[model samples]
Target: MSRRTVLVTGATGTTGSRVLAGLRQRGVAVRPASRRGAPAFDWGDQDTWVDALVDIDTLYVVPPIEDSPTGVPRGMGDISGFCKYAVKQGVDRFVLLSARSGRAGNPEVVAVEDVVKALGVEWTILRPSAFHQNFAENFQLNSANPLRQSIVDGSLEAMDLGSPIDFIDAADIADVAVETLVGTGHHGQTYELSGPRAFPFAEAVRIIARTLDRPIQYTEFQPTAWFERLRATGVDETVIGLVEHVLHSHDSGVFAGEFDTVERLLQRPPRSFEAYVRETAALGVWDMNQAANKAMQHQR
Candidate 1:
């Protein structure tokens, strides 16, 4: 039998990076693809697709959100076309990374899944909640993230709209992605993954504060102010729209729930928010110097 050749898009991203590591650990042959990787793949550039898809049996898709000048996202620019090309290349299986917002009728998520399903191939969809890594990596540390400003300015303002979010760990998402990519019994299934429990943003920050033994104050950002803050931080409209949708979901209590999909799929309880906080805190990433170092490491 031929060995499995899995192509992972967004290979250096939060879950994609973890997925790559997990696949390698399992001794699976993985071809990492990004806009600037060895097997370079760009959604807007069809010329790069062939190289990324060659000899690949399965794809672990992390959909790109490339924004156009008009605040519209050209995700996978033409996912349908890409899927057809992959089919032609003998690729028959796909595992897509979607968000919990998909259930709330997120247009981009819906469109991507629709394309994957229409491909007439084995497909699995993972709708994961907000990633716990968001706090330590993207939200607090990543240069592009507006919330990173809070880390510098000592103003940890976020939406405190009373609803609790079940933030799943990216590692858990990667594990499930690996299983669906390599294992069986998950094709044509859509799994809604989440952490074991849900907690409000304030409580989550408090946990981090306690873990770091520092005074990280959480300020409430009303809807308008939140949008304004994002704009002021130079966040583009595409991301702003998505962020607004997510904020609406949370404020209306859509995110105040948990799912057992992680446990059901992985046969183990997902890691808790407090545990994630403690572990990340131990890494000294909350410190500005450490955060800079971590950001540099991620960019590499």
Candidate 2:
């Protein structure tokens, strides 16, 4: 196979970075299109978009972060106008990173999907579950609070930090995205990729605590307290609204199930949660919390 070239937007981000690596592992030529990467690209700015996309047959499009938390590509504006422009620019295959919003036919994503469909190109949609990186990278979970066992159930079956709720790695998403691009069997279809297990938040916290030998815990926030606390974190109002929205999602039972799309499709079990935390910690993410965080993060 003459290795196909791909332009990956958000190439430096958690999942996009991995996706880029995944492409390389498969012997495909990859042009990393991020402000930080070689052919650095930006989403909203038009100048960068065209050139990075030039000569590329496939794209892994992760819309720039919207003020909202759903990770919806267009409703907040960045991608709404870009989709039509992308197909019009002569790109053939598109794999957009979308969230579980508005189902498979969200007006915004569908609008872009419609554009690609009309352009007579092969397109795939990847709707991934919450990332395992969110734990080690979430910032909120790293507190060295006077630690409590109440937040985690050690006896409950648990996996590593990479486990829980089927959190798929970003690179895995990219690998699959690229596969759909070079191959034709997946055109016009959407996939929901998740980690291998359906775990409670408590189990996730417990495992992290045990692995690091830290006393961290998952404290169930009283609704009002939770909102007030997050609000105090200087998170913007829109983001605060999104957090509440997620809590509501959990309350409504929207996030309480497991699906097997990742391992089923890739034929490899996703990395376990504990392995995720341990590795990141060894690399110094969790293992290097500042002395200030020890007091400040736990103070609240």
TM-score of each: 0.86, 0.75
Q: Per-residue CA lDDT of candidate 1, range 1-300, in tens? A: 235789998787888899999999999999998877987888778999989998898998877654432221355546778778998899989999977777777676777888898889999999888888877575211246545446433459876665888889999999999989998888899998889988888887787777766777678867788778778979888777876776666677666669888898889999999888888767765676766776799999
Worst 10 residues of 2 by lDDT: 145-154
Which ranges of candidate 2 are over 4 A from the true structure?
1-3, 37-39, 66-76, 101-120, 138-164, 226-245, 288-300
Per-residue lDDT of model 2, residues 114-183, tens digit only:
5545656777877776677765443122332222222222222222222235556665676677677666
Name the runs in model 1 displaced over 4 angstroms: 1-3, 66-73, 139-153, 228-244, 288-300
Q: RMSD (Cα, Å) of candidate 2? A: 6.4
lDDT of 2 at 287: 51
- As a whole number from 0 to 100, the lDDT of residue 156 in candidate 2 is 28
Q: How close is candidate 1 to the true structure, as a TM-score?
A: 0.86
- Give me the candidate number with maximum lDDT: 1
